[model samples]
Target: MTQRTIKVGMLMAKESPDLISLVGYQTSASAVLIGLDRINAENLLPNINFTFTWYFDECQPYKTAGYLTKLILIDKVDVVFGPTCPEWKARKISGGIVL
Candidate 1:
C-alpha cells in the first residue's frame, strides 16, 4: 500500500486576553485535534496520515486572507479547516462565491 500524508491548515485564534474567548479557542482547537485523533486511530483512511499546521488569525478578514495564502503557498497544505469569523472573506479567498 502506498502511504500518503495529507496536510491540513487551520486558521484560529490561539491567544486572547478575554477569558471566555480564550476558552472558546482552546475548545475549538481541542475538537479538531480529537477528531483527527479518532480518524487516525480507526485507520479511517488506510495507509494515509494526517498532519496539520495552524495559524492564529484572530478571526480577522485580512489576516485570514494572508494566513490562508501562506498555508496554501508556503505550507502547501492539501486542505484548510478554519477562519470561522470572516466566513465571506475566506470563501472569496478560496475562490468560492460569497452569496
Candidate 2:
C-alpha cells in the first residue's frame, strides 16, 4: 500500500493552557505524542514532519479571530486541528480555513 505523507499543525484556544493543566490533557498529549512517534518510526510518512506551536488570545471572539489569522498566516500551517472553544470551532470551520 502507498503511504500518505502530510504535514500537520496543531492549535489550541488561548484557553488551552487551562485545559492542558488538567489530568485529561496530560494523558491525551502523552498518547498523541507516542502515537505520532510510532507512526514516524514505522515509516508511514517519509516526507512528513509535524510541528506544533501555541497561540493565545484574550478569549474574546474578535481576539480569537485575530489569533487564528496569525496562526494560519504567520505560522504557515498546512492544516490545523485543535482543542478550541465551540464558538472558535464554528468560525474556524466556516471561515478560518479560507483566510
Candidate 3:
C-alpha cells in the first residue's frame, strides 16, 4: 500500500521558535518529534505518513483562537494537537482535533 504524507500543525502554549531544543509543558517539542520517530521506527502504521510542524500561540485565549484558525486554513494542516488549555479550547469552532 502507498502512504501519503500528512501535514500536521502542532500548537503549544509553551513553545518558542528560538528555543528549538527547549523543554516545556506536558512534553517538549523535541519529545513529540521523538515519539513520531519511534512510530516510524516500528513501522507499525506504514500506510500512514506524518509531516509535523510546530506552532506557538502563547496563553492568550483570543490570540490562540486566531492562531488556530490560521493553522487550519492558511497552513492547511491535516491535524493539530497539544498546548492543551481549556480556556482556549472552549472558544474554537473548527480546525484539527485537540488533545
RMSD of each: 3.7, 4.7, 5.0
What are the lDDT figures for the candidates, one per model?
0.74, 0.56, 0.64
Q: Which of candidates 2 and 3 reaches a greater lDDT?
A: 3
Could you estimate the TM-score for every candidate?
0.75, 0.59, 0.67
Off by over 4 Å in 1: 17-25, 93-99
lDDT of 2 at 12: 47
Worst window of 10 by summed lDDT in candidate 2: 5-14
* lDDT: the better of candidates 1 and 2: 1
Residue 80 in model 2: shift from native, Å? 1.0
Candidate 3 clash pair list:
none
lDDT tens readout by residue for model 3, 1-99: 787888887766565544333334346666777887888899866888887766565655666677677777778788777444446353454434443
Score candidate 1 by lDDT.
0.74
TM-score winner: 1
Task: Quote model 1's TM-score.
Answer: 0.75
**Which candidate tops lDDT?**
1
Candidate 2 vs candidate 3, TM-score winner: 3
What are the runs in model 2 whose C-alpha is more than 4 Å off? Answer: 1-7, 13-18, 21-28, 57-60, 88-99
